[model samples]
Structure formats: C-alpha cells, structure tokens
Target: MDLQSIKDPSFLKKMNNEELEALSADVRKFLVEKLSITGGHIGPNLGVVELTIALHKEFNSPKDKILWDVGHQSYVHKILTGRAGEFDTLKKFKGLCGFPKMAESEHDVWETGHSSTSLSGAMGMAAARDLKKENNYVLPVIGDGALTGGMALEALNHIGSAKTDMIVILNDNEMSIAPNVGALHTVLGRLRTAGKYNWVKDELEYLLKRIPAVGGKVAATAERIKDSLKYLLVSGIFFEELGFTYLGPVDGHNYEELFENFRYAKKTKGPVLLHVITKKGKGYTPAETDKIGTWHGTGPYKVETGAFVKTPASAPAWSSLVSETVRRLAREDERIVAITPAMPVGSKLEGFASEFPERMYDVGIAEQHAATFAAGMATQNMKPFLAIYSTFLQRAYDQVVHDICRQNLNVFIGIDRAGLVGADGETHQGVFDIAFMRHIPNMVLMMPKDENEGQHMVNTALKYDDGPIAMRFPRGNGWGVPMDEDLKQIPIGTWDVLKEGTDAVILTFGTTIPMALEAAEILQKQGYSIKVVNARFIKPLDEKMLHELFSAKLPVLTIEEAVLQGGFGSYVLEFAHDHGYQNIIDRMGIPDHFIEHGSVERLLEEIGMTTEDTVAKLKSITPKKQKRA
Candidate 1:
C-alpha cells in the first residue's frame, strides 16, 4: 500500500495482523526517508510505528481521545491520519508542525510538545465526557521519562483516586533526551524483568478454581497467593497500589501482543495502566545503536550512512563552551558542582560529569526538584551550576522565586538555548526566560555578546556569592572569537561599548548584537553617529553608563531577542522615567503572540528583529542629525 494515500486509521481495522506488520514496515521506510531530508524527531517516531498503529486500530480518535505526552513521538500518528503527503514541508515555516497541532487535523485531540502533560489533559477530557454522559474512551500515551515528572505523578495520584475511566499507555524506552536516572528508572527496570504477570496470574487463578473444594479458608489462601505474586513479580507494584488495574509488560512491537493487551485494557473498568516496552530507535541501525540520545531529534542526515549533514563548525557549541568552562573551573574550585534535569547530552555536561562524577548530578525530568536541590547545595556553601534549557526552566518558576531568589542564595543558573529555538515550534521557544527572570528581585540576569564573553560570564557567575545569577546563551555554536589567556570577572551591572557614537545609542546583547552593529553601520553611512552598547547585565541596568547616555540626550533604542513585555527594553524605559531624562526611547523584541516553527533567521525576519527594522526604528527617532555644521 502507498503510505502517501493513507486517508485515516479506519483502513487499519480491515487489515489482519500480518497486513498490519507490512504496513508498519512501509511506515518506517517512509519516516526514515522523509526525516532524512526534513529532519525531525526521527528516533521517537520510528520507535512508535507499531504501537501507534495498534492504538489507532483499537480506538477511534477525534471521538475516543488519544493524547500524546510530548508530541515528538507522534510522527507515525500523523502518517496514519492522512499526513504522509506533507512530509516534504515538515518543521519548516508554515508547514506541518513537528508536534501535534489541533488545527491540522481533528484526530490531533490535544496539542503537546512539553513532557508530562498528557495524563492531566486526559483526566480533564475524561471528566468532560462523564459530565456530558457520553460514551468515549480516553487514552494517554506517556514515555517512561515523562512518567517521572512531578506533574505526571500528581496526575497519577488524582486519576487513581478518582478512578477515572481512562487508559494510560506507559511507553517505556528507558530514555528521555538522555539516559534515565533516579529511583523510577530502577522500579521500571524491575518491572521489565517481570514478564506478563497478568497472564501468569490468570493461569494460576484458573488452576486453583479447577481444584474444587477450595472455599472459605482455601479461597482466602488463594487471595494471599495472588497478593504474594504481585510482590514477587513486580517489585514496585506501583500502579496496583495506586488503585489502577495494572495490565502489562507488553512487547510494544508485537502486533498480536499489543492487540491482546489493548483488548484487555478496553474491557477492564476504572483506570488501567498498560505498560509497553519499546526501543527508542527500533528500526534504524544508527538510532538503535545510540546510547546517549544523539538521534532523539536531529538535523538532516545521510540515509545510507546515517551521518548528519551539517556545515563545518567555526566554533564550539554554546553549551560546550559554558559546561567546559565550568568543568575547567572545577579543577581549581572543589566547591563547584554541576546539575542538569535529565539533559546531560543536550547541555553538554558529559565532560563535567566525567571529570567530577561525584559532584555532578543528573536529576531525572524533575525541573522543580533540580532547582531546589541546587538551592540546598548553595546553602551548604557548594557552588551549584544548574545547567538547564530556557523552555524547561518555566517548570521551576515557583522554586526559582520562593526557594532561590527569596532566600538570596548563591546558585549559578546556566540557562542554555535562551533565544528563539527554531524547528521545535512555539511550545519549545526560549523567548519568555528574560521577561520572567528579570522581574524577580535579587536575580542577576545577563547574556553574553560572544563565546569569549560567555566563558568570562560563567567565571563571574561561579565567583559571585551574592544571590542567584543566570547567564543565558543561544542554541548553536559561538562566533569563534579570540579568548584571553587568563580568566577574569566582569564587574556586575556593566555594559560594553562596542561602538562609540554621539547622536544615538543602541543597547542590545547576545544573538541580537550582530544585527544591532549592522543597523548602526547603515545609520553611520546616512550621516548618523549611532552608538552600540552590549547590554549584558539585564537586571542591574549599568545605571552609571545609562545616566551618561541619557544625560548626553542620545535617542536610545533597545533591542533584545526576548519577549517585549517586562524584558530588557521595559527595564530601560522604566530607568529613563525614574531619572526624568525625557530621552526619546523605543524598543524592539518578540511580540506578544507565540512564535511557531521555522529557521531562526526566518523567525527574526517575521518578527521584524532585523537590521532594516532596527535602522527604520532609529531613523524614525533621529532624523539623520540634520547634516551637522
């Protein structure tokens, strides 16, 4: 069958087990070929081929709600729902999204990108269905890594207590971006060894019933035997204890096994947990052999060789630059410890872990826990460098405020991928970090102009013992700038004057600095002397330097690659108002709306964060200096 012609999962109901197996092969081929060109969540999608097919066949989507927790694994779901033809434009601007989008198809019941949301979403849907007195099943497929999230655990407790009519498919591949960590992984490990307990228990029950004369006392003994079996088989017995009808250790790839378990789960009442074991990269050899999660999501790759097709690198990645700097500093400072919330690979903390395995900690997908854990270490006089992505840091906002900021602890936060992260779409963009972090008191927030400045900032952050300080960096490699022989601490609340001008001043930092420079050059050609200041420290505001600029009465324009509201620009405006400067001020940044999937350049252009826009904003404020004497 042509995978492209697939209209809906309705076709799967007509096919036998062997036919479904053939369909799975075709779907795998389609994904490998398509993702090689467009680049996407290839490993996750490939792993769920059969499982997704089984799910679609067993349940009617759009009516029977099937929520995917972390929509990266929904590529096969897309193919089954008549989206195989849209592969050419995957993850591109105005193309099929990399995650589940409700607007694309009715089959996509819930949109997702962030982890550990499906269970809660499913519970809500189930509640709605019951209120309406409707007959519909709700299924939420969650990964083993996602199951460890604080939100997911909370949802499990509520769902079990309510006995909500829903099915939870625990898709355990033993990884979430990086290899699994913490006690949950160990519990799942024991569960993996306990094979088909449901079948074994059923057989035992039938044998005991056939023995006749088993009554009262003998029946009570059978109950004890069943209770003992749960303890003997599944080490945790976690789901059963939580008031869920525990169903599996099912082989996710086997069509017959999947169908049997799906049928059983459908017949059972109350909440059911169908634990399915899968391989992260099931079909592709390179992704299958991957142990460190390089293939989790990626750029375009060579199909035959499985080699990535990337341009030659000019400098080290920002994550490597920051983590390696911390690792290098750790050699001298025994107090420096590194922590990541399950992103050892993404944050490039492997070197730090390898060097100081005792000091380094990888706390599973618990961002909230990771934040306070760092705070605890800070209280003990140990410098904890919590390396985490900007998008994920949102999960720990409460901890950041109450625990770290309120206490005024000396925790160093390495905010990785701190600007517009392209391709993964709106849910994964890092635009809101500065806006959220800047408002909190005693929080020192900054972004580096380049890799050299980044290393220096890392040194500054680790050395500072005042309060929580964060240094945000972009996703890709640095600009290959020259480095100094010795490390130095930049004074807090300072800005670098990259270009000197008298007529106007352009304050910007991080990814937007290059464009600001270009805009200034364009203005210079038009007889306008525009000053460019690297506004590295976002919070402290470099007040003394700012006063000098305001006193000179330069028409100031602030630019940042972050949310406009409560961001760097807003801070500058507030300072001017408080000082009664009356200097003509304007601001540019991400608009109030969410930015979707696209290349970084394209996104910038779309949001008018370009040299032309910057020049236009400046040109509007200062009219070419009136061709001075």
Candidate 2:
C-alpha cells in the first residue's frame, strides 16, 4: 500500500510483523526527505517511527487518547493519521503547525509545546473517563528529560494515589533538547542497566516452586523470601511503591517487544508505567551520531552530506552577545553565577559554562524552581543571572512575583527570544513577556535596539542592585551595529532619541525600532518630520521625556512587538490619562488574538506591524495642515 494512502492506523492491525517493519522504513524515508527541505524536530521524530507505529497497531487513537508530551515527536503520528500530504506546509504561515494542535485533527487529543504537561493532561482525561463511565484507556507518552520537571513528579504522585486505570509510557531517549540531568535521570539510568532483574525473578520463582510438599509455614517463608529477592534485584521498586504496576525495559524499536508490553499494560487494572528505550535519530546517520543535540530541531540541511544550509548573517546572535557579556562580567565579579532550565546550547551559555563550570546551573526542565533558586541566591547577596526563553519563563510567573518581586531581590533575568520567534509558531513566540512582567512590582524590564545597547543593558542589569531587572532580546541575529570598547551603565527610566523632528514623536524599541526609523525617513521626504525615540525601559517609563513631549503637544505614537493590552503602548496611554496631558496619542502593537506560526516578517505584516504598516499609520494620524505643507 502507498504510504500517503494511509488515512488511519486501523490498517496496521491487520499487518504482520514483517510488513510493519517495512512501513516503518518507508515512514523514516519520508520524514528524512520531507524535513530536508522544511526543517523540524527531525531527531525526535526519526527516533519514534517504530514506537509510534507499534502504538497505533495496538491501540485505537482518538478513542484511547495517546497524548504526546511536548508534541514535537508527533510528526510520525501526523503521518499515520492522513496528514502526510501537509508536510510541505509544516510550520509555515496558515499551514500545519509544528506541535500537536487539537484543531488540526481529532487524533491530537491534547495540544502541547511546553514540557511535562502530558502526565497532568492524562490524569484529567482518566478522571473524566471514570466520571462518565467510559472504558477507553488514557495513555501519555512522556520523555525522560520531561520527567525531571516538578509538575510531572506531582502528577505521578496524584495518579498513583488515585490508582487510576491509565498507561504512562516513559520514552527513555536520554535527552530533552540536551542531555538529561538531575537525580531522576540517575534513577532511570539504573533502570536501563537492570535488565538482569527479569532473569533473576524467573530463576527465583523456579527455585520457590521446587519446594516439594511444603506445608503452610514453609510456603509462607518461601513467599516472603521471593518478595524480598524481587525488591533486591528489580530496579522498578521505586515505581512499584508509588502504586503503579511497572512493565518493561522494552525495546521501543522492536514491534514484538513494544506490542507485547503495550498489550500487557492495556490489561493492567491500576496505573501502569511502560519503560521503553529508543535511540533518538534512529535511522538518519548524522542525527544518530548527534551527542549534544545539534539535530534536535534544525533548518534545511543536506540529506547525503548532513550539512546545514547556512544564511551566514554578518552579526552575532542576540543570545551569544548577552551570554558572552555575562561571562566577561563574571570574570571580575566573584558573586556572579548563571542558571538555565536545560538550555545551555540554545541560551548560548556554553562559553560561560566552560569558564565557570561550578557557577553554571542547568536545572533540568524546572522553570519554577530555577526562578526561586535565583531569588534564594539574591537573598544571600549573590548576583544570579537567570537566562531563560520568554515562553518558558511564563511557567515561573508565581515564583517571579511572590519570591523575587515581593522580596525585591537583585536577580538579573536575561529574557531571550522576546519577540515573534519564527517557525516554532504561536506556542513558542515570545510576545507576552512585556505585558506579564510590567505589572509585577519592583521588576524593571527593558529591551535593546542592537547588540551594542544589548551588551550595555546586560552590564546595567547586573550592576543594578535596587530590585529585580530583566533585559529582553529578540530571537535570531543582532543588527550589525557598532560596539563601544568599554561597557557602561544605562540610566533607569531613560529614553534615547535616535532621530529628531517636530511633527510627531514615535516611541518604540527593539526589533520595531528599525521600522520606526524607516517610517520617519519616508515621512521626512514628504515634509512631515517625525521624532523616533527608543523607549527601552518598559516598566519605569521615562517620565521626563514623556512630560516634554506632552508639554510640547507633539502627537505621539507608541509601538511595540508585544501584545497591546497592559503593554508599553498601553502604559503610555495610562500615563497620559493620569497626568491630564490631553495629548493626541495613538498605540500600535499585536492584537488581542493569538499570533500563528509563520516567518517574523509574515507575522508582523499580518498584525500590521511592518515598515509599510508603520508609514500608513503615521500618514493616517498626521494633521491635515502638516500634510498640505
């Protein structure tokens, strides 16, 4: 049968083991070729081909609810569910999303982009099933790295205590982006090597059966001995104690082993955990050889040579500049330390980690703990730089407010990817940081227009000892601006005027600054001179400049690459209302609705945040008298 003709996985139930293996091969080939042009989470998807096929054959999806944690590995699942024809538009604007979208198909029972959510989601489904008197199995496939998250641990406790009828597939690939860490990883490591436990259990059972004509006392003693031996030899004792029936150390790639364990798990009454071991990037050679996770997710690459298609930007990436600046300061400041929630490579902290291994902490997928951990360090007068992506930082809002902001600590937060992150889509876009962070008391938030200002902001954040300070930087390469030889501190509550004019004032910062400047130049040619100011400090607005602009009665336009509500522009409007300025004010930013997956340019255009959109907005608001002149 043709691979694309597969509408559902029901056909897999009729296929033999040999035929299943052939299908797995075809799927792997399809993934490699498709992803070669449109890049994605190739390594993860490639690794799970056989395991995904096995699961489909054994269980009915949509009805059974096979929830994939983090959803990046669901490419194979999408293929089996008749979405293979949509591969060309994967992660594109208005096209197929990278992660599992409930709107995409019925088989995608739950949507996920953030880690460690599947277990909790599965527990909810299990409880709902019982309440409705339904008997369909509730299964969640969670990775080993995601298992280290506190939420996953909490869910494990609850599900075990409830003794729910569900299946938790512990997909052990020994990675979540990078290599797994923490004590949970250690426990899993022990379980992986304890394959001899089954042999020991069988041998002990045979010995117990050999006690011929044993009476009640002898039989009881034998039973007690057998139980003790089982605990001593088996590595699943931890899970067993947690009220779950533990199964496997099964080979995820082998159909027979996977099907057998999955079938057994389906029959188990209480919660059952099936430990399956599979290799990430199982089929492709380059991805298979990856040790540090270069192939986890990537852009276009050559299939034969395994070489990435390079665009070769002239400037450094925003993450590298910020991390390197922190590394330089750490050389002089002994109290300086860095923390990341399992993103050493993505956060560009490898240099810092290499120089100060003891000072760097990768907290495994625990964002909430990482935030408070930084707060705890601040309590001791240590300067902790928490480097985290904006989207992931949402998970630590409570810690940020209750622990950091309330206590007024000096934790320097480096908010990486703080704007429209392309390709990864709406789930990963860093657009909400401004609106979320601005409301928190004692939290000083700002962004930079270029690498030079970015480095200065880094220095400013680390040096500031008053309260919690954060500097947001957009994803991708910095604007190749000239840098200062020596670092300097930027004053709090200050704004810099990039261009001077009298017709109107444009307040904007970060990625949108270039657009503002372009618009100003266009307006300049048409005799409508405009002023462009970098409103970098988001929380503590530049009261002095704002007052001057209002007093002069210059029509003002505030723009940002973030959501409109409670954002920088909204704050400006609030300030105008409170101060009784009666100034002509207009705001431009992302709308109330969620932005979808697309290129940064495409998303900006969709939201009317482009250079052309900026010019059109300025033209609409310009005075009739000024236009005639």
| Segments of candidate 1 deviating more than 4 angstroms | 199-214, 218-223, 626-629
lDDT tens readout by residue for model 2, 1-629 = 57778798888889999999999899999999999999999999998999899988888998999999999999999999989989999999998899999899999999999999999999999999999999898889999999999999899999999999999999999999999889889888988988734335445767767778756666667757766876776765778778777777888899888887887777668999898999999999999989988999999999998899889999999999999999999999989999999999999999999999999999999999999999999999999999999999999999999999999999999999998998888789898999999989999999998999999999999999999999999999998989998999999989999999888999999999999999999888877889999999998999999999999988899999889998999899999999999888888998998888989898888888888888878877767434434
Which residue pairs of candidate 1 clash? none
Q: Tell me the lDDT of model 1 at 319.
A: 97
- In candidate 1, where is summed lDDT lowest over 10 consecutive residues? 620-629
lDDT of model number 2: 0.91
Q: On residues 72-124, what C-alpha lDDT tens digit does candidate 1 reach at each position?
A: 99999999999999989999999999999998999999999889999999999
Best by lDDT: 1
lDDT over C-alpha atoms for residue 147 of model 2: 92
Residue 269, candidate 1: alpha-carbon lDDT: 85
Alpha-carbon shift of residue 376 in model 2 (angstroms): 1.3
